[model samples]
Target: MDNIIKANQFIQEGKLEEAAKILNEAIQENPNDTVAYVNFGHLLSIIGEKERAIAFYQKAIEIDQTMATAYYGAGNTYYDQEMFEEAVGMFKEAIANGLVEADAYFMLGLCYYNLGNLPHALANLLTATEKNPTDIDAMFQYGLTLAQTEQVDEAISVLEKVIKLDENHADAYYNLGVAYAFKEDIEKALASFEQALKIQPGHLLAGNGKKQLEALL
Candidate 1:
């Protein structure tokens, strides 16, 4: 439909009001158009009307219970609001309904992390990385999670992989240094922290790490 296409175009152009208007009319004309409901909900969310957006998303799901994207969109909104448990439930439902993106698993990992379920967090985050190897944030979180559980060697291994991916990654280097320090490999830790400083002169963690290493010298 031209209205549907126009609404999407308006959304892309940041004309959320126009998009919402068109989508609302389109849905009224064809109440069964799940895409219209989803697009309208997305536009409402962009315009900061979260409650209205959620209402429309619910309508979309009511029309098509198997609409995985609708579940994902609602889950993302819940996650953004820091409602971790609700987000986890919605994401799990989305996945069960066939939403097979890495993002679903990644968000599940974050929810588990916040809830202090470290082992589950690691498992979900690792699954996320396996699904999308280029997921930088997932790798970083995985490394951090490993460190939290005293798996220093595994943490270092994961962070080192991040370094191989991006040599200038200051945080990865800093974390790697911490992992090495936890392992009592002072020399390697100092070298890693110093390398981080080379990339980011004002890196607070690297600077502190360097000073601590120097104290040992």
Candidate 2:
């Protein structure tokens, strides 16, 4: 419990290095403590050492095959690295291993989107949004995927919902502008671009959108 307590304190203080040190020592002292390895992996991830994090997570999984969190972490690491196929495989394995979480679905959606598997991405993201409708990232990503698939109306609806939920969501407004432009609704497009610019001044995409709209006007 000493190591665990120290690790917790380090994490709470944002001392990820100290936490990883303590967790690594704990793992060395007790290699069977898969939780320590998993937490260490998570700490490494926070510090942006993705490959090391994946290795740590894999070590935990090797020691305890039933460590679903390890699989989930590995999946996220793969996804972050843009290894969509591998990420998809790992996330699916996590789900099959009963690692049910809104985040898992969200990650799966992202992987599918990156893989250009629009239908699967849409389905997974729909589940994520349903689980946590307030998830700004999920809503924005889902809307983007919908727009990519030519569902401009649906994309606008989702992006609008995101903007309503998080008024400062500049990306949502920017994407909504794109959706409106795709739908040939110049007025709505202009309004959405303005909204984005108001929230995030100098937002390049929104600025470009405004410029393009002005030309048409």
Candidate 3:
């Protein structure tokens, strides 16, 4: 089997040390292998060695300027370090290099969201959902973004879709309640909040929202 493939299997098995050994050997044997370098970078990032992971990813990029995975790996490492600007640059490069996948778009959206660039975040997150309609997490985040931007009706629709995707998502239910409240649909808001509490008994926000709406009635 290929050394990188073996290392990946070891990684999946939670044998980090073994994966490291195989990846190191693979790099030594074929120093120009961009895939091996990116995999090693990913493993190192998982181990919280962010700086070293960035170095390996940069090495991969150096070997192949068009290596999209290298840029994506570096983007994730930068994001882990809270370097949103660097992450944005790396993610954009990854996209430019043909990494037009939902995962990449989702990460880029998160980076923009963190950087307080709502418009960019919204655009990227919408693209992510278009790429993978079944991604509940992405859909959920997009709904929150819409709510934050005061697009209450649209937010409600998206949050409803999230609930359909995962009936037990307390956060989605809670946010749906918030959207309903914004539109003065008190009964529906109260019901959504109650459903959220039923799903997650300790949901403080939902509990508080239910109380506030009840007081109004």
Candidate 4:
């Protein structure tokens, strides 16, 4: 097998030192191997060496400006560090460079949401859900964003989809309850909160929502 493949195997096996040695040798043999550099960056990132990982990703980008994977790697590191603005820029660059993965759109949505750009967040999250309909997290985020924007009916619909996707998704039920409450449908809200509590008895938000709604009714 190729050195890169062997290094990837070592990485999957949690042998970081061996993987690093092989990747270093690969880079030494062919300095222009952008793939090797990007893989090394990803391995370093996984091992908590964020600075080193960014360095390797930068090197890969320097070698090949159109390498979307390198930009995506750097974006992930920035996102993990809570540098939402930088992550948003990097993810946009990755998309511009032809990266069409749902994860890229999802991260972009999360970044925009964190930056308080609700419209952009909703747009990207909508795309993410379209790209991967089975992504429960993306659907949940989309529902939450809709609720935040006062689109309570749309939020209820999206959150219901999440519950349909995973019956035990207590958070989805909780959010659905919130949406129903916003719509002034006390009975439906109470039912949604009860379902959430049934699924997760310790769900504080659901418990509180149920109590509040009951008191109001």
Best by TM-score: 3
Q: Give the Cα error of residue 190 in candidate 2, in Å.
A: 1.1
Candidate 3 wrong stretches, greater than 4 Å: none
lDDT of 4 by residue, 28-100 (tens): 9999999899999999999889989999999999999999999999999999889999899889999999998
Q: Per-residue lDDT for 21-138 in model 1, tens only?
A: 8988898899999889888888877877777877888898999999887887787777777888888887888899988778889989999999899999999999998998888888
Models sorted by TM-score, best on top: 3, 4, 2, 1
Candidate 2 residue 166 Cα shift, in angstroms, is 0.5
**Candidate 3 pairs with clashing backbones:** none
Best candidate according to lDDT: 3
Q: Model 3 — TM-score against the truth?
A: 0.97
TM-score of 1: 0.90
Q: Estimate each model's TM-score.
A: 0.90, 0.91, 0.97, 0.96
lDDT of each: 0.88, 0.89, 0.95, 0.94
Model 1 error, position 159 (Å): 1.2
How many clashes would you count in candidate 3? 0
Model 2: residues >4 Å from true position, as ranges?
A: none
lDDT score of model 2?
0.89
